[model samples]
Target: MPARAHKRFVLSDQPKKPVATAGGTFRGDAASFYLPDFCDSRAAFAIVLIAELTAIVLSIARQSAAVGFWGELARAALFLLWVGLVSAALLCWLRPRLARLGVGPGSVAALALLTLVVAAISACVSLLGHSRLVASAGTGAYFPRQLWPFVARNTVIGFVISAVALRYFYVTYQWRRNIEMRAAARVHALQARIRPHFLFNSMNTIASLTRSDPALAEQAVQDLADLFRASLSDRHQTITLAEELSIARTYQRVEQLRLGERLRVHWDVRGLPPDARVPGLMLQPLLENAIYHGIEPRPQGGTVTVTGERTAQLISLVVRNPLGERQAEREGNRVALANIRERLALLYGARALVKAGRFDEEYIVTLRFPYIASAPPAGGTRPAHAAPGSPEQ
Candidate 1:
């Protein structure tokens, strides 16, 4: 919990990308839908097995043939199915908190209590509905007594499950931390590739104009300073879409200083959720890909367009660049898209994803992820990602 809170603290002031504040909620990508292996089916199945066996044992001990083998198994199966359904439903809300280790022992105990309540409700149904079968088998009177032991056993089982869940939380934290470190390293490498090369590229552009336009050369140097600083700031992994776009826009401005009449950028943002989130430094890398692979190769650079939208369940984003002449699939040099996709998978599970491809004359990449946001207060629309210009401070 401390670790998770610390992480939140670290990212507290970062910029928020496009998002919608539903009520007072701070909504973003569904990457928060990730859940680890704490909830195991085998364990749940075992709980049902014990409960039904207890019921059957009591029925037979009372000389009642009502709760036969199949009947007992059926009852157990139903109870467990109830548990599964309830947990699955709760996951939609609980998943985000769990991803960041926000769930604690108390939360686990509360869930246990809820499960127990459901269990009791199921017990009442069984008792009332099957009274005749139970009575004829001489087990009706002892059924309540049989329930006590299962209840007790189940309570202990719940505790065990909670303990396992805590362990899984720790394990997941470790796993996620490892992934973050690797991504940070990769981003660091990419930043290096950008700056030295980008600086040199800009310097060369300035050098070409130094003889004819000294004032423009000086302005280029200043733009280059702002560009490098903006490009290689804190080196964190996640950022709001707004922060990334802010940096991207700044970087593009710097590029314009160098590429005068060739580069163009347009935004098609009609579909943005207004509170979407994305990896920090994500856009810059892809933008670099656009500049280097597409624009640099062509003497007359093309346009880069960014589009974002939201469906009922997911946030969708696509970046399109118009520079695909030959289009031989360079299948292997796809680390940026690959790493980003991997991170999204680990963060969002299967619900959030990204895909990059090329068609006839354009290279495009798209991202789809579940939309998760902080809960909103009463009587308010969804909130923005955060304050702008306070760009991920």
Candidate 2:
């Protein structure tokens, strides 16, 4: 069946202006200063558990056989829980503002807030206990003797515990950030590997077409420009599914200009949600690999079949092309598969999947990733090169 076009690609026809390279550096700095998202349920639960464990340990250290020991333990647990929840809530609220600060300043602010919360809670608890002691003993003398000592001890303990916790958090954040940077570097490297080949081949095609078909050559040049523009974009962000498909279409058209009728494509993407967010340049590389390894080697090229479908939670895309000779399946094919697989895993964690192999007489590559809805085009309009019902090709 003929695929139905969605407004997504039409809207993306005018790609966002090329962003400056410094944008990435700025993003990195902002991200590095961000405190952990304390509002997250998992993070909140972790804080609660750690606070409870610390309370238990401290209570145990002071344990005695007296029945009042149980009361003390209970009070300690309740106090710690209150302190933990309050700190978490305050941090969650301050995270955005803190992220804007320099790393050193942000850390100091977070630590200060934590200490303040703990001290305030401890002071309240100590004052209440001192009042009760004074009331029962029928003498105000105990307040001066015990209140300050109790508050000081608890405040010092809270500061130590909070400092230790912050230290651990900083270490963990650094570790995770390093891992993310490594993955991003690897992805960029892989993306770089593909670009030179594409650039050289595309330039050569445009160069050859200049003499015979100047108009067609100009169009090819424009398509090549579009491809490179998308290539230079932020790979970490997602584009609309339609935009991704449009990029693939541009890549295919460029190949068709070079290979003529031999490079055929049939797209069955009616089932796809046009506004679904997908990693940028995701679909084009597969088509490029298909053309490079599958169609380019044979004297008579083959058709590349693309089909897409969306489930409630996932979106799947399948690319099929006639299998080339075993010798034609060289390093390029393997590199493309590995690059795509790694990119998907990095973006979607375990939820993304890539499967490739020969099925019957055709080579097939299937990709599956979680469905991500995109917001409506801003101002109720986006750049459009075609009508909503226009054929994708």
Candidate 3:
């Protein structure tokens, strides 16, 4: 009689363990490696799709002659989707705080939270007249005996699955971070290459003027100073089209001091969105390439024309310079074009285009990139190749 009474006591105590002893909530900042954003619409959609697939698999794997296959599938789907969506919502709310706990603890807490959700849902369905859904083979009278076992089984399964999922997220996050760091490093190196080439050319231009015309040399120095100051002051990877044009014009002024009648420039950028964002120092290198190959070599100076227009989906820019009669001198070294192409690819992926070659009697370079409006609010848009599981700062 005492053993029977003790058994009843133990059974009664089992139900409370599912919720009460699962785990405590955690808190944290955004600096730590965390789970993906379940709050995002795309992520939520992915979760739904994966859950449905898992439900179908479970139904097929656990087939039994007594169970109605369609009914079993539907119930499994309903249970899984409920558990998934509820887990997503709970974790979405907890993610920012969880970031403070660091990756190891955060992952454990997330797994515990997932297990608790599964156990709670299983307990509810079992107790609230839905025991047939949980213990498919058990009758009404036998369901109470099956309830604790069902919840325990679910909690164990949830813990294993959640651990696998969290590990996958961490691996994915690390892979993406590595790719971004490499791209950033490559871009910085390419940008650095342009600076030394530009400085050497500008210094030569300024040096030529110092011997013939001291005042013009002084003015050139000022223009060169302004150019360097503008480029150095802004540290962002991209800048407004207007700002890039301003830098191009400053370069044009410095070139004009050296070339005199040989260098002529025309601007037709009225159709362009001055606020369109582009890579910093993008235009200056193109102009320098034009002057060095197409204009400087010929005795009679030629014109360099910059034309730009914005279409519905893209911003188009064209730089054209009259080709010298000597085909050898007119041939571009193409270092600048290659550098620009690499930078464009890094920043905008395949959305950016660059083509440079001969067009009629001109050496022309055409560039096209998606139209980006003026500076957005902080944390507004994700960058190309951005790592998942972390919000942009």
Kindly list the per-residue Cα lDDT of model 2 for residues 1-393, writing each as its tens digit.
Answer: 001111221221222212111102323243555468888999999978987887788678876444345665776678889999999999888887887775567778888888888788878766765676657876443222465676677678778877887777766765665477556656653554445776788889889889988998999999988888888776767777888888888888888877888889999887787777677777887888777777887788889999988777788999988877664545666666656655665555445667777778787888888876678767885443222322221
Evaluate all candidate structures by whole-model CA lDDT and list the values in order: 0.56, 0.70, 0.70
RMSD of each: 15.1, 14.8, 20.9
Model 3 weakest 10-residue run by lDDT:
16-25
For 1-393, candidate 3 gives per-residue lDDT tens digits of 223322332332222122110011212456335478888999889889988999899989876555567766777888889999999999889987677666667778888899899999989877954545545755443233467888999889998998899878876765565466455545654454435656887799878879998898898899888887766754346777777888888888887876789999998877776667787877887888788778987899899999887778688889999886675732234555655655664455445667777878998888888877667548865232211211111
lDDT of model 1, residue 122? 55
Return the TM-score for each candidate structure.
0.46, 0.54, 0.49
Find the number of clashing residue pairs for candidate 2.
0
Winner by TM-score between candidate 3 and candidate 2: 2
Model 1, span 160-181: residue lDDT tens = 6545655564456445655665
Task: Compare the candidates by TM-score and give the number of the best one.
Answer: 2
* Clashes within 3 Å, all models in order: 26, 0, 3
The deviation in Å at residue 276 for candidate 3 is 1.4
